[model samples]
Target chain A: MSDDRIGVRKTYKLAIGGAFPRSESGRTYVVRAADGGFLANAARASRKDVRDAVVAARKAQVGWAAATAYNRGQVVYRIAEMLEDRRAQFVEAVEAGEGVDARAAGALVDAAVDRLVWYAGWADKVAQVAGSSNPVAGPYFNFSLPEPTGVVGIAAPQESSLLGLVSVVAPAIVTGNATVVVASELRPLPGVTLAEVLATSDLPGGVVNLLTGSLVEVGPVLAAHRDVDALDLCGVPAELVTELEQLAAGSVKRVLRPPAAALDWRERPTPHRMLAFVETKTVWHPVGV
Target chain B: MNWEYAPAPESRAIVDLQPSYGLFIDGEFVDPGDGSAFKTVNPATEEVLAEVAAAGPADVDRAVEAARRAQHETWGPMSGAERAKYLFRVARILQERSRELAVLESLDNGKPIRESRDIDVPLSAAYFFYYAGWADKLEYAGFGPSPQPIGVAGQIIPWNFPLLMAAWKLAPALAAGNTSVLKPAETTPLTALVLAEIFQEAGLPPGVVNVVTGAGATGAALVAHPGVAKIAFTGSTDVGKGIQRELAGTGKRLTLELGGKGANIVFEDAPLDQAIEGIVNGIYFNQGHVCCAGSRLLVQESIAELVVEKLKARLQTLRLGDPLDKNTDIGAINSPVQLEKITELAAAGVAEGAERWTSPCALPEHGFWFPPTIFTDVSPSHRIAREEIFGPVLSVLTFRTPEEAVMKANNTPYGLSAGIWTEKGSRILWMAQQLRAGVVWANTFNRFDPTSPFGGYRESGFGREGGRHGLEAYLDV
Candidate 1:
């Protein structure tokens, strides 16, 4: 197949902690486009992949969090720059796979990159707008601050693939969260490509892992998993939001529904830090001063 | 599961109007261990209904502890079948005394006796009967292999349909083997208090369904109470947001069923007479004290004039007088405050340039009554169109196409309910899909069933309250 117009082969694996690796299960599933074109035989991530992702997230979370907020912002901005450099490729690929015009494809990719820049700026500043010092009755000087909600399980949107996937992934990670996102079953090429970008970016391994497979087979596994802290169900099927909502409540994990089609995504307000996550800390001081 | 229709004769003696009251905690009624009594008025007659006990933080603590104790040893471990039996007994007793309860509801809630008898009372009994069946068949509810009760629930109901709202809150909680400390709305606490009596007569365990009569302070106390495991509230959007904010940090489980400025859209293809009737029932039902009331009418421009004309002619026949009278249709505005709100919003509509009209219905000199009112030439941004008046006032607006109707209907923040009056089945299906409201009533306005899910979206609040979905509020998955 390496003749004049034949295609070159490449290996597809799970993206974890900014690296590509084979599944621990050594299983694979063939991916096909809507037209029945063979895309690739991608590695099927196992439960072990979920555990490793959690461990990697736990490892990187402290360092990522301890870094100055401005520094994190700078790192996030760098990814946006990388996305901008590869803009034409994304536009071309989105048009080819999603069947949109070049102009719309370009706008889609640009919006995705712009969202990274937008939320990157929010990484440190959201706390200022969302939390405050409360005049709660009694005792010590009390204040509230937003904290990461740990590992989030995201079901990336099925259509408007590029921009939708970026919108969900950036918000979770920008707030110091790690994510294991299940790409769309019918349109996952953009997600897998975006994962390649993250693999080369500053995102720590396992901090953002991308998986491509059947959502019906995989969504319940992520939902019922005790280790998952929160869920961003952007692309979840309508018939299943309630069931997933019920399961996510087991640990009181914060669950956000997908925005409606008519919702003004560009104008929608960013949720306050305290609104999305909570921080509970215990401070011990001498009783007698 | 049996529903009986009985004429509820006018009665001013069932309710003993008093000056003030105290909290009902444990099994005794006491002045809030903190002295604050709220004024409760009969919505039908602008009369001071009673003084209700406003529970303070301390009282909330006591009530929560009592509920916890009750659930811990008394009610929690009871078999599902046993819970069902108690609910069945409660349902039977409610039916046996349906007329008295209906009269009490009409008096306190200000809904016409016809609705109180035919709609509210029967529906309340239906909720109890339906959930009673589910008490032993929870596995069939699709929860999972295992579903458990989320212990003590603090429920807050509204004044619209006092007894029905209480049944909505209590039946599911009790059927799921959960204890509740329920706070009835300050204006309509009698039926809920009577419901407590029914529980007592049915030999229900103490604290299984405690009624604490109070206003915002009491509701806040219950919602903020730490000992309570879950909080379920049915009220206004503003109060719902406050509760959501208060529960922000506590990680307390919550389910909110709040306000809705529902849109009842009528297309030219609709059955004109039936659509007009639906429009009347949509906004004028319970004198528009419903959270899901169709306060905004989006009439297709092709027949806008005809629909308004028909709607106006139908409004003339609606009787507005004593709520206890079986023939009364529109009845009285729930209270003076609600009437004032309706009057203020209606005046604001005229001030904002909407053509205002009212049916020539006479009001009693003693009660707080308002005629069924309509406003035309209303812009999408008019307060009468945008804001919730929560009374018998409808703002009329015109749309050109299906897309425009859907757009105008879903423009508001409240997504509780929408009514699509069209004979085209395909059009209703399409509109139902596009309109984002939780409940979509097609060719019908206020038709409700124990099997259908009902609630709101966005600011109208989260969580369903009826059918299989209602179990979510009481379940620990």
Candidate 2:
């Protein structure tokens, strides 16, 4: 069955508003394997692209958040199912981009799939864990519930492309926030492929917009975006964290700073990530017949 | 026939005024390192009550050092039960001295004596008592199995509810076993200084709680200090943003309870009399110095004119005069600076073409006073409807549908608090879910309890101040 045929290569593009399009700047950057072999050219997203993604995210946020929590859970779990189906493709991308052995890459892909399933379970349950029925000393029946912080801007981790990107994006969207994510600048193939999985998994368009570009250029624009209600700076460069934070302060965006020490992606995730971007809304009504 | 009631004044003799005061550091009243002093005046009469030390950077540093020492030596290593006892004592002492504290608070903060006596002072004591129980119950708080304190907390509170804000910040931090360096707002430092006396009478350990009184520069120094691990501030949105920016990469935990222009929505089906009372309490209480005051009134268009007419008639009954007068419904503005800001913003409302209707109450000549005002036909774009005037000014806007009401209510960057008046239970619940605010009250407004968590969303800032959720701010999760 060995025939002399050339295999078609996939064209890498930015995912914004559930559609794959070339960067508005019409720019592309070369992506190389660990051994410096040219893998492919990825769309180099510009500040304009960031702005478009934010608008898309804002547009989709209300609908996505309005969906029943159970429906959201199923949609997230569907993403896991789709990712599991494309495990081999992600393993190959991770292996090349991260300079890891096939087994290591496979393990990373498995963890990413499991992370999605883990977050899927939280979509419906997070409110119960994070919210409370306050016993106010009055005639009022008071209760507090967690609501999603509107549009979140995420900078995916520079290392551990697939797992780290999945780790950040899942917790954000599972809590019903629409996201504008800047993927791993050096190795964005796995992130874009993950976007493909998301697009087909019944996730709403614009719920998860992925961009591949320089974080230095895109980070500030995303941080400073007035439409963005929150930020996850897990992958922001150390030197730029303060500057980006200052920019984020202008709009009072809820910011999650990077860990002081490098995180091990293999560690079991905590609910803190999901809770960080939620606002606890307490409602009161008089207790009367 | 015209009838008038004689003035019923609350006795100022309840509070014993000191000629001069020093900063409370290391459980002692000490002079500021920089020998600078400022006079604190009673806003109702512009009478200089006492000369208070103005703490500088050196004082802030010393306070932080003392707090850090307390954390390491007395507070952190102590058992939760032992800590609970101290907090319990503090609560008891607060309740015992509440009358004196309330009188001083009214004098310094320019709030009505009724509010200071009934709401602010009692709530301060209630906060201490509530957190006192939580001191020994950390494991059940759900943060973790053995949550640790986040070292010294630098607490900066606004002047609006001076002693109550102090209680909101310190009770939780201390109950969680952290030491504190508190910066009381410059205009209202008297009650907090008296609170220091209560802490001493409770036999609290030296350096456990330090009070530094100064202006913005001292607060800036306290915020920038390296030894502080957490910062809990309640103030304007602009200053909150500045503090957030300053602590950018410092790894310090922060919780801010900032400003808001809350909306109070009234539907046609609402109980008319009760809704009118709620509307008055929502904005006119505390002279509208409250951060979560319902400054924006969103009424059902069918009843908008009726509501405004009733509101105007009700405003005329509000007595605006001396804070010590028990019958007075509205008090003096906190300071000349705050009065000027309110006047400027109210003028902007009139200039922006909103119809302003001010009450005909006679303002006292010697004090800072602004008549209770209402602006009808206020567009969402009007400055009065958008910005936090922090005075007795209410903006009235009408909407035809529930959806429009929700949309107009959430139009601002602030999401601190809101109120809904409707007899229908389902609509109340639906509006509560739709409005993007931290606290939503149905059939009531400006109601607070120690067990109820209070905070805000969006640009109004983050973190709850009361109940179980407040423990997370002081704990290292």
How well does each candidate superpose onto the true structure, as a TM-score? 0.66, 0.99
* lDDT score of residue A148 within candidate 2: 94
Where does model 2 sit among the CAPRI classes?
A: high
**Candidate 1 Cα errors over 4 Å, as ranges:** A1-289, B1-9, B12-22
Q: For model 1, what is the alpha-carbon lDDT of residue A66?
A: 58
Instruction: Tell me candidate 2's interface RMSD.
Output: 0.8
In model 2, how large is the Cα lDDT of residue B375? 95
Best by lDDT: 2
- Clashing pairs in model 2, backbone N/Cα/C closer than 3 A: none
Candidate number with greatest TM-score: 2
RMSD of each: 18.8, 1.0
Return the DockQ of model 2.
0.80
* lDDT (C-alpha) at residue A169 in model 2: 95
